[model samples]
Target chain A: MNENNSNTNLSSVVSNRAWRQSAPWIAGAAMAAFGLSRRSKSGLALAAAGGALAYAGWRANTSESDQFLARGSVLLNCSPQEAYQRYRNFEDLPKFMFHLESVTKIGERQYRWVALGPVGIPIQWDAEIVDERENEFISWRSLPGSELTAAGSVRFEKAPSGRGTILTAITHFDHPAGKLGYAVAKLFGKVPNFVMQQDLRRFKALIEAGEIATTEGQPHGPRSLKAAALKLADPDRPLARSAPMSEILKQQRRTA
Target chain B: MKAVCWMGTNKMSVENVPDPKILNPRDAIVRITSTCICGSDLHLYNGLIPTMEQGDIMGHEFMGEVVETGSAVQPEKLKVGDRVVVPFTIACGRCFFCQQKLWSCCENSNPNYWIAEKMMGYSPSGLFGYTHMMGGYAGGQAQYARVPFADVGPLKIPQGIPDDKVVFLSDIFPTGYFGAVNCDIKRGDTVAIWGCGPVGQFAIRSAFMLGAERVIAIDRFSYRLEMAEQGGAETINYEEVDDVVQTLKDMTANVGPDSCMDAVGMEAHGDNPMYALDRVKQAFKLETDRPIVLRQCIQACRKGGTVSVPGVYSGFADTIPMGAFMNKGLTMKTGQTHMMNFMQPLLQRIEKGEIDPSFVISHRMPIDSAPQMYKTFRDKQDRCTKVVLDPWATATAA
Candidate 1:
């Protein structure tokens, strides 16, 4: 009975796929005839064209054979070395990715990203930089156990209209449930993409807006009050206020 | 895209409008199946509620199936096919209020991000399809609605319970339950519920379920009074009675009720004929002494009794006799219903077949007939207690 059920399921899947592939043509023909009656031949033609375009877009956007193909690109105003300083450090990605609360660098190329999940669940993702080139391109694959396992890349290219670089991100993941999973991923993924995209733009703004990198290669020490104040003003500072003034006052009073 | 819009005072219409879509990752587009004209909506329908814009979608009580959701939304918990009953209030679970379990006042709860602060009052968050001051999120009284904070606001329907039975739980049921809970209704306590509207009816019933020995429901509407009686409440029609407070005190052996629930909220009509003119004038001027019931509740409650107010109040400028309240040593607990906290327990009760709240629903019509239903309900005609609007119905054949 189990074998029969499996066979039935497989056959049904095949039949469904066949029907889906043919549905557009049938719909197009019907729409074309109806469009002619309504003096909307152009509408019918447009409908057919739209269907073709949509199908092509879907195919191009998805992976036919799930061999973990992911691609992404990012544009930056800074040079490759400056961009590499930020991008190479996986732990610091959370600084830009607001949704990502923390990223723990476990190994040279591996990291664990802790992100806020729906209904208060902490979603954890294990990722590894599968491919890396000095500063032009970096690709990573998320390890299994996530709601989704994705492979993506970030590439830096010259901006089409200007001097600043154009950053492009492209990713392809195995959407198991096909349309349903694809739809779900599109919905949820947009938020992180938006945050990351905005961060990239901000990074470009920071670089082009002429921010001096002062802490580079400096020994970790208690920063001066002026330096601390400047650091406090950084938008990337997690907490709005670092330490309470009362605590500072109390410390000063005790020292006195 | 069909929406029941509050055009002006005593003017409302169901008109075609743009379909709502998922504009943010925290948003979900729901194809509304069941939406209802709420009593609070009548405040806008009659232009009593302030800051209402023309073509504003009215009616908040609703249930729908998720058609689309934002990327940040959880598909596992809420999928496209899952049917859900959404609270009137929108809330983002991560916000200050949500972290404190005060989902009704979430900071990031508005659908229109531009009007986030101005959408609702200083309270910050509230129901969809309300006025400009209450999130201005087009209400569920339409073919489609964009539910912000879907994971937090939209609750999954438990299997086996009919839609009508559990529909009231979305707002009134939970509000009433909150009232009973807030009153600290102990087993065998005598409870009094003010105003026998749908909420009052539920409060009376819920008080009984919560172990109130005697639930006295006060109202002038005979039909509502009958509803309360059927729901196991001893009815007191104030129209036929001389003094409702005295009558309630008489029932409670001169000590008054152990607890009193003010279910009337902000738009409660005054019981006295002399006060009716003032009440109408106040309602028109956006100044309401709905607190008369509140004062009555305080006066009618026994010393050390509790008063639970689940009614909506905003832009407060009312003086209650705090000295009298203090002397009486009564506990006053009032706020929005934390529906999420009570949903599971309520769902359990429904699952056990212990409560059937569909008795409040007096009219069920197509969504397009909402304007007519709203008028009927507003006028309190045809004994329309509660009207449920079905969005799937085809527009009336011209």
Candidate 2:
């Protein structure tokens, strides 16, 4: 899991878009404030650059981009045929993908997806398979009038020297928060490319090692020096995801 | 179980803590019969390495019996009652890095991946009882320690060999051998090494083992220099020398040594103005490491010769003569020892009586006396070179 935390307080699409629209002006005012205080040639140049950025942000917030694409790839230990077969079983995706809820087949070449939003909100969408070549590629796009407008494709190929199969995924979408939503998501480590890479790693672990190794409740990097010192005092005390050894072992066995 | 914990800078205490149990499928519990206070532990003691916690158990080089095993460990490879020396680096064997034999860079071992990625570009393998960025799995300084990825890391020793004879295999011996290996020593090459500490002592012996025709070991301490001499290395007391680099050039007829090794690491000391400058910068947190020895190593090495470093440098180092290094066409090799690669072969070397690594041991004490021994080791008191602790021994006994 990416476990990225957003800094923004506005959760709804309308409020998020409104915040995005105002962000450039806020940055411009801050830059101008500093520039006026300094009152130098470099300061004026910085102020002018900030003004240009503000205007660009204003223009970007006015309309969504035609399409924003995210692409990522991973090398899996499984054969291309096995990898494609497993991917074709869409209902099993939620077993490995933490963000996905369900993919239910509603009709031939059509499906309904219930996915978790930024928070716990449920996002429902309907999509039809635009194209598919068994053991090679698959592509899909959301139907018109759906809550989200997006298209995605995945390609499978044999790795050079027959090391294993290479799985590549491409996703295109138009965000309601406009281009600013991408900026915010990237800042928060929620960039779709990173998420896709992590998801592929998890998938590879499931297909190859049979279990994802974790130190969930164990000691981890400290938030601060003081917290690290406190951890030094009584490290045996569990932190967050403490679980019995047997239960953790059982989880590993289930994956195997 | 009584375990040694780090309280703060230069502060350590043995406390009654719960015994370790298997926490992962590949985990195993080792009842540590012998553990040693490493020279690097002094770095943590002196508060150089960041991310250490207050109650963190703090020993890494250790050996013991496997009293319990997690389900994922194959019974045929590891089992109860096996005497084993566990490497300090934790590796998942299945990771891409592990398959490439870069055990220290294993991708699946370190749990603090995000933090390490932010600091080091990518995470290395998890380490035992070092710091949080290295996975903070409790160390073996206590009566019991949890071993992760047991199938890959721990080397099972034979029944006849004493723990003292084989214990150094976990770190110093392998580290020294790998340091020499990184030098890519050809037969009859001249190798100059900085720092006559334990690792340097081993490096001196290992250079000779690798057929280095001449080895010059440099340090300020008389006892360590004497020990290096005993290991078949020519000694140079830098404190007595007018100019070490000039002296090295004079000794090598101005061509410099074929290969130079910097085992002094981040905490090197010298009276040079640049050393003084680095000291001030390091004190004010402007620089993370003092690179006096490394600078000298680069300046003193022959043009186109290799510089191998086994020193533990935690963060950024300042005042490095990079221009000299580049113009001289020097090749620098350094990494954490891939313990899995060297342990068994080095163990054979120990068993064959070719080298008794125990020459470094100068003090032995109970685990309860670790705090005082830590001070003694750090201060070079009583001519101490290395200190080994018996977890079951009484605190007052020697």
Candidate 3:
């Protein structure tokens, strides 16, 4: 085997670990297929895709599948201008956006977003609104060399007969080891797509209703035993009224 | 404070937990004086409902003294030290559904909307002490409970009324009233209702109040049937009858009652082939609901008559006899109780001594007895039709 082909195999295996799990068992079958066929890189890629998503015992590295492309839309009982303005202000995002710790406005149409990463690490990116149309649409993307790559657009359309505003948001982001981000957030029962949908709902609530509804810091029974042993982020863990990840861990530690 | 926690399926225990505090701007802390075990709580105890995690608090029918109020709560709406009966359905008063008086369908109160949206297409309002799918708000079966959207869902009780007379304003009374109201009972209308639980008992009396000439109540338990009889219902013990549908038809001059109600929901009991089928399916999680009563209600109703279901159906029900439902051209009305809508009017009814809501209570136990009480209630032991739990009662009170 040549060094180049071996290197290609290594990266291909690492890039799709979710599917390429059971690698050792499947490697034999793949090697057998390779021997039967004329040498072709495309055949190797096909073999990996056909593998099952069984977790490999020797687990390491993150797969690109772990990333998220959150697309959600919600109807708000308000004017398009109100909906657009409520979403346009970056600083108010943490109130509704579950994943964001804070979005600080640094320059005109520019903002810095801090989000939680694996094991208390903070992932941040600077972003600026690229273009905007009053009460209609706005588009934005992350700056170069940021820890995360994100691009998104939001559109507000007035429903017929003056009913309300239809707000739609489409966002795609690739965080470093994004799988860990999903796993951590999911521990609190918030998936990325669900988070985006809830964020849109929260946005609607905040726009039409003055405050978002939640049950944060309520009391429950046998909490200490559950809090100390399994340390499970219980299902009753309230909405993301507080920030995510490290902050939640700190609270759990204090209670534990 | 001592609170009841769900350890697992069929396991409940009272434990010490911190006192509840205001969690939102419209929130209030209620020191629970009276809380009740509902028939629907059996759904949680039997593990028929999903999204119930271990250690989740239980109980929803409760009334208490408001110990603290949040800044956003207007004094005219609610104040500290006020006696209030809390509704189980949480709603933000500004939302579209709340404005339309469909408080149970409020969109914002459920923090876990996405979970519900997946199952229900559109989620309803959050419920206290229910499951996470219903917003996972810690429930009121404790010493002190946090109530969100406080100004909207709680009704102030005048000082003179006893807790037993008014605690049911939280759910069953409104639910039964809604059931009767949905029946659209005209003068001399005849109504047949399935189930004789607390809700069914209230629905029976409410039907009479709404001018129904005759009310037929169906159940297997004689005690429940006797209670239904006391509410002016003609009893049909389903176990003694060979064929309930035919019996109802024969009794009603070969034409069914004008309206039929299903107060017994997802988990129904019967000695029939369909009941066994539904039970087998339910055991395997193949179907989330047992439509035995729903099916009978549809099959037994007169042609073109209305069917009112106040029963709680969580998910998909199999073999619903839709052909009968559609061919008969029946009108059906069903939903969770919009508590804010019926609460105040019913409070006046109770105050007037029109109908005492407390007649449904057959057991009154201290909070610590809740663990054993759950089993007694589920098993229907000790003629336990309904249990009212006193949070402050000492262990040896009995």
- Using lDDT as the measure, the top candidate is 3
* Candidate of highest DockQ: 3
lDDT of 1 by residue, A1-256 (tens): 0111222232232223333355344434433332332234554563465446334533343343221122224455456666776667767765554456788987788888776542344556678876667866676667767555655566665555443466655443444444433332322332223334444533443343222111112112133364465344432221111212112112100000
Question: Docking quality tier of candidate 3?
Answer: acceptable
Worst 10 residues of 2 chain B by lDDT: B110-119
Residues A1-256, model 2: lDDT tens digits: 1112343432332223433445456545644543443356855775676567555644552345322334568787668998899888888877666567799999899888876554445656788887788999887778988766766777899998767799987655555463344332332222344456556766766565545555444422113365544345433222221112212112100010
Return the lDDT, model 3, position B188.
97
Deviation in Å, model 1, residue A96 alpha carbon: 14
Comparing candidate 1 with candidate 2, which one achieves the higher DockQ?
Answer: 2
* TM-scores of chain B, in order: 0.92, 0.99, 0.99
- Greater-TM-score candidate between 2 and 3: 3
Residue B268 alpha-carbon offset, candidate 3, angstroms:
1.1
For residues B1-398, could you state the per-residue lDDT of candidate 1 as single tens digits? 78887666787777777777666566678888788777777766765555455566777888878899878677776888788888887765654356678877654553222232332324456567775445456777888877766777778886666789877767888888888889899898999988888888878878888898999998888898898898889988877888888999788779889998888766665657635654655654534334667777877889999989976654332546677689999999987777887776787788787887788899989987877887899878999899998888875731
TM-score of chain B of 3: 0.99
Q: Residues A1-256, candidate 3: write the lDDT tens digits.
A: 1112222333332333333333444333433342223234643552453233223322435444332344567878888988888788889888887657899998888899986543455667899887778999887778887666766778899988766888877665543454434433232212334456667888888876678877667877664454444434333243221112112222211100
Q: What residue pairs clash in candidate 2, if any at all? A: A232-B53, A232-B54, A232-B55, A233-B55
Q: What is the TM-score of chain A in candidate 3?
A: 0.60
Q: Which candidate model has the greater TM-score, 1 or 3?
A: 3
Query: Which residue segments of model 1 deviate by more than 4 Å?
Result: A1-256, B111-121, B158-160, B271-274, B280-286, B316-319, B395-398
What DockQ does each prediction reach against the true complex? 0.01, 0.09, 0.27
